[model samples]
Target chain A: AQSVTQLDSHVSVSEGTPVLLRCNYSSSYSPSLFWYVQHPNKGLQLLLKYTSAATLVKGINGFEAEFKKSETSFHLTKPSAHMSDAAEYFCVVIHTGTTSKLTFGTGTRLQVTL
Target chain B: GAGVSQSPSNKVTEKGKDVELRCDPISGHTALYWYRQSLGQGLEFLIYFQGNSAPDKSGLPSDRFSAERTGGSVSTLTIQRTQQEDSAVYLCASSVRTSRDNEQFFGPGTRLTVL
Candidate 1:
């Protein structure tokens, strides 16, 4: 079975400060991972994905994540947080098995303050 | 090109009533998925359809839930004898194909409230 764990349920940062959201995973085979953001009452928008090509992946809105095989972690980071970045974020994993089913983490809510 | 679209952005039904949620994937996309998001919970996979192949319905919670993709395009999720605990946001997503790299595009989602 494959699953993801979001280390924090909520994160708060002041505008222009660095942001970090941690995630860990457990998968039997090679795994595909992703980060998605959702605004209030909106559908989820893809932020980035790591498909084994590179350990570091950049995403929209200046967000990025690094896949660490040793730690079983894929942590999202941003140089500076913006007010518009306040939202809910999810970390997902797709097992490399035939089904490739997507498993999602509970989620981390980001709150950016001015 | 249009993205995935779902109908009845919001629906409210009495307990024991049946409801159907619709989804239209991007043109030419061969994979459609259904998920449920409860308050403070992660998105739970409900079903998946790939082309004309038999759907993977292993994620469905109970017999009260079922889905069908018609003619390989539009899809509908039906919930029979709904209960209050069944209320949640039903989300639909589609991908170009079923693969590890294929990104799934999501729709606005339907908020279901069972009274």
Candidate 2:
């Protein structure tokens, strides 16, 4: 069984400050991890994914995440947060042989303020 | 290229009424999935369909929920005797099975409210 936990339910940051959203996972096998962002009333948009390639993965909108195997964590980070970055983010995990079904975390709501 | 699309963006129904939600997958995609998002439950997988193979329905909450993909293109999710707990946003996604990346494009979703 594979599952994900988003450590923060809400994270508030000032515009132009750094942003961090923590996530941890438990998977019996090698897992594929993903970070998705959802704007208010909008469909989810894939921010990034880690498939055991590079430890550091870069995504759109200046967002990136590092997959730490030892820590069992994939934390999303952005050097500078913009007002547009305010949204709800989800951490998802999927293992092989599960028909590609995703197990998602509760989610982290990011708030960017001026 | 058009992404996944869902119909009846919002529906309000009385308890015990049956409701149907539709999804149109991306062209040439062979894999489709249904998920539900509610206040209590963040996101829950409901079902999956790939090509002509049998759909995986292990994630369905109850027997009242049923789904079908017609001609490997469009799909419909039917809920019978809906209850207040069935109110949530229904999400649909589709991906190309030929690729190992497993990136599923999502639809805007249909919001269902049971009164």
Candidate 3:
């Protein structure tokens, strides 16, 4: 049983301020992590994925996340927020062995203000 | 290229009725998946099909839920005797199974409402 917990249900930031959406994971083994964004009435788009590669992963739309093994965290960060960045973000985990099913977090709703 | 697509963007049905939802995967994707999104459950995997392998029904919530993929491209999920708790947005996704990246492209979900 692998899962992710999004620390915040909602996060607000100014247009030019840095944004942070926290996520923590619970897994018995090393698990692949991912971040996805869903705009209003739109399908989810992958932001970034962390396999066994780099600890610091960069994603589209100026977003990045650091995978901290000891802390069991994969927090999404952005240097600056834009109005277009307002969306629902989900943190997902997959243990890719016998099954490829993903376990998703409750999601964090981002709100960017001018 | 067109991404994964789902039909009947919105559906409203009465309880105890049956409903079907369809999904069309990317042209060359070998793996397809079904997921449900709801306020109560967040997001949950419902089923999975990969190439010619037997479909995975481990994620399905109950016996009333079933799915099938035809010719490895299109899939349909049928829920019999739907309940109000079954009302949720059903999402479809496809991916190239051979690729280690394992990124899945999603379709605009079909929102199902049971009254």
Indicate the TM-score of model 1.
0.98
What's model 3's overall lDDT? Answer: 0.94
The parts of candidate 2 lying over 4 Å away from their true place are: B98-100
Query: Chain A only: TM-score of every candidate?
Result: 0.97, 0.97, 0.98
Find the 10 residues in a row with the least total lDDT in model 3 chain B: B95-104
Cα-based TM-score, every candidate: 0.98, 0.98, 0.97
Per-residue C-alpha lDDT of model 2 across residues A4-91, encoded as one tens digit per residue: 9999999999999999999999988778999999999999999999998999999999999999989999999999999999999999
Sorted into a CAPRI-style docking class, model 2 comes out as medium
- DockQ result, candidate 3: 0.65
Clashing pairs in 2: none
Candidate 3, residues B1-115, lDDT tens digits: the string is 9999999999999999999999999998998999999999999999999989998899899999999999989999999999999999999999988343699899999999999
All candidates' chain B TM-scores are 0.97, 0.97, 0.97
True contacts kept of each: 0.63, 0.49, 0.63
- lDDT tens digits, residue span A1-114, model 3: 788999999999999999999999998877899999999999999999999799999999999999999999999999999999999999999756655777899999999999
Can you list each candidate's DockQ?
Answer: 0.75, 0.62, 0.65
Q: For model 2, state the Cα shift of residue B36 in Å.
A: 0.3
- lDDT of model 1 at residue B36? 92
Backbone Cα, N, C clashes tallied per candidate = 0, 0, 0
lDDT of 2 by residue, B14-80 (tens): 9999999999999999999999999999898999999999999999999999999999999999999
